[model samples]
Target: MARSQIQDVIRCQYCENEPAVFHCVPCGDELCPRCKVFHLKSKVPSGHNIVRLSERLHPANQIKMCEVHSSKAYEICCKVCQVPVCIMCIQEVHSEHAIGKIQDLYEKLKAETIEELTTIKTQLKSEISQRIKDYIMGEKGIKTSHEDIREKMKKQAQIFINDISAILAEALQESEKDERKYIVEIARHTAEAENFEQTLDQMIEKWETLTDSTHPVELILYRKQNPDIFKLLKLPNKLSIVMPSFSVGQINKSQNKHQFGKLITSKVNLIKSPVESSKHIQPTMSAKGNKSKKRVLERSVKTSQIKAEKRKLCYMACRDDRSAYISGDGPGIQLIDRSGTELDNISTDGEPIGLAVMLDRSLIYSEYDNKVIYKVALNKQKTEIISTEHNPGGLCCTKSGDILVCMGYRGTARVVRYNSTGRKIQEIQTDQNGERHFSDPFFICENVNKDICVSEWNFLKSKLVVLNKSGNLHFTYDGHVIASILKDRFQPSGVATDSLGHILIADRANNAVHLISQDGDFLSYILTENDGISRPYGISVDRHDNLWLVEQEKACVKVYRYL
Candidate 1:
């Protein structure tokens, strides 16, 4: 009784005579000790959360009252108006509207609020933290790039200085040699003049002494010795000094980056909202692992075949959805459409061994006759982009507009990367173990992950060599053991990668195209002899993810929708 009467300001809502002792959470009912006993006898709902008045979800006796009927508390909620109503209001204005228990709606909304808070505290926060870290890393990358560019500029200046010093030293040495020879000739002439003067003085003194004196023998002997001296002494031919001259050359004002080098700045946006990410994100479904499902090659259908005049098709580079560039043991590279109509022709010195296209639709190709890579612009103007030290076998243009060249001379093979303007950026030759990465890299491609994939063949066996963007050796894939028909004759000719990071290699000897996971695991033969593909040499993936294959035997390009 004393506990019930502890507080007088708050009385029992059920029995307003004593202070409230207990509260029902679901019903929102306040009860005193005396009223609580009667309320329990009235058969309250099961699992009703009842607690002390102090522990109530709301303040004691604070139930919401209907605004239309001030004397009544809200119990039912109108579904149509979404408002709480009392018994009198429900019977009058809310009679036509659907009604629900107000307590149920309150519980549902409460649960939803709690769930949203949890998500904000966990997942949303974590995502924000990760993005911040990525931003910081990007900042560091920019600074590193700045320092690297400065270092390159200093190195190039040093090279120019060294070259000029060598030329100047050679010129100075030649000039000094000419000066020494001129001085020797002048000294010899001076000595001859002095000797002639001395002989004249001696002859004059002898003639005077012979005129005054007595010995006829001395004068006679002197006349005999000096007989030709009186005739004439021809003066030495006049020596005119011929000085060395130097002409200064005019400085080249052309700011071509290929001559020296230039820094290229690219715009990068790192912030992405969920809605924006869906549109900007690449199709990375292939990167997702599917270990549970068995790998199988889906049947490929040739959607279109493009006939070409060149019998030996070597490489194919897709320019867009409508057209592609094809090269082989031919005089020029032909740009053709699906209907086999020639759109444009790029003349080459000889057969183009490597072919690729830039993002701007410019054609990049390397000819077998020269160790140089050339770019053909949209105006049909061709310019030398890169001059490699060795003959380039294949060329690939990366998403960032960099070119990867597969080059080798004699037994040495390597993959070199250059920026769009032809400055050497990277060279992937030996691995961490100092071992050669490829025997003969014939074709090259960049994967979705920026891994450099090279099709290497040494006539004995062919392999697919893959390296990470940092030029580290990722893996090397020889032909799968199950390919018994290509046991000893597996020759990887053309290599390409798709949006899924899956690598596809054309096996010219086996008449198949092998698809493998980016991790170097053999997936399946996407195109085989059964699919009417014979001597598939060059392969490429279009912007729409369609596979383009050049069939050497058919002298045609086949577009397949294997994906």
Candidate 2:
């Protein structure tokens, strides 16, 4: 037989009574349903495990109830010791004590506990509602993300099918043309053979009839006339049909196909979706174990740092905040509060060119002449030095606190990363194909997704270069028309991004600031005034998303608030 499950009984912490029904108020002692008793000194009456004598009694006013106690009325709690006592006990034990009514103390304690319980219940309800709202939002986000991916996949599949069908149709037409050409050539050759055979038969009959002296000469003349006839009749055993050899060059013209050189030069080649090499091809393993191991170490260090500083303040108002720092060519980085007050200014060894803030609240500023980054602390102290290869033009800090500096001159541009200790960790001066990155990288900023964006100025083109985290070229955007409309002097000088991932570029020559999307799409202009900005060199957006522009020639920093 199976054993029946037993239910556990709930009990008060202070009492050891079984099947506890009543809860104590003073020290939360539990009592059996029948043994429960309530002291008159207790605060809470109902909803408590301890039962009052009045609730168990039959008549409400049968016993002469005291006005002070309400149930068993008492004149005073105590005179000297402030302890609850009957009139007789108070006169003997606490005669000289200042007496107080028991009812007043009981009412005060009851009110306080009721207030506390009400506050606790309100807090619990609020927390539960907030959690429910968060769950709903999370579920909505997941659904939207799934729908977006599905739509993208559907469109991508349609494009692939269209491209494939076009390529296959062209191939089929070429194959059919080659087949028809071979068929026509075979028919023409057969007709030529029949004519040659008929001519030979007529010549043989004439030779059999004429056996005279003139017959030999006639035969010789006929043979000379048709000297090439026999040679033509004995057509080569296998005629060269000249069937069209599929060039395979058409495959190269298709954009979807990979480079032919890469395919042919590779050790392993694929034919009709299968390997068809005569020699056994061993798997080629990479020899970059050391490099990969270093990358893993760097990533681990970055992850640990992120975990340490887990305090995430998503919203910060920069208008009246002193934490926002800006750098210009004046002297050094100007430390200002949210109210735009200059708290303190730190001087650099060389002219200030760029500024970036690290995770530890330390400021990194690049000097133009010295080509070095000076680390400044909050105490107005210079700490470390970061050396760069070229004249540092721009500075930005990544999410992992890595510093990215833009350096370039003439026809070369690069974005290099450095660790917090002023050591160069990585450099990206060229594209994946080993081509020079850009003409001149004037400004650089890291996006939320870790991609580096550069404002480049070439002799003929002024554009922005977007590169992935691995330094691969992603896209380029040319502001040709906008530059021309602004009087052909739209050189991008300073670049910065907001929390929303919107990029703002200061067009120094054009005297305006252009706003661009995270994907290099031109959104609009932050500054539409023609002559409002004067040689803007440094640009920054504070925590409040207010635009700060450093006008180099004007020798003034302009602040614009978002309306």
Question: What TM-score, over all chains together, does every model reach?
Answer: 0.48, 0.46
For candidate 2, the TM-score is 0.46
Q: Candidate 2 residues 1-563, lDDT tens each?
A: 12332245654343454566554433345555444543323565222334432343333212333443455434346534545566555443356677786656656656766765565467645756886897788778777776876686677768878888998899999899878887898888788887767877886777676455465777778787877864565643447755466665544356544322112221323323123321122122243322232211111110000010111111111222234455543455456653445656666666566667776566777776777778876455786577777888777778787888888786546778887787888888877577987767867888767778888887777877888899888778766446443765557877777666777787767777777777878867657445355666666666545666666655555566532
RMSD of each candidate?
24.2, 22.8
Candidate No. with top TM-score: 1
Best candidate, lDDT-wise?
1
Deviation (Å) of 335 in candidate 1:
0.6
Supply every candidate's count of residue pairs whose N, Cα or C atoms clash at under 3 angstroms: 0, 12
lDDT of 2 at 531: 36
**What lDDT does model 2 reach?**
0.61
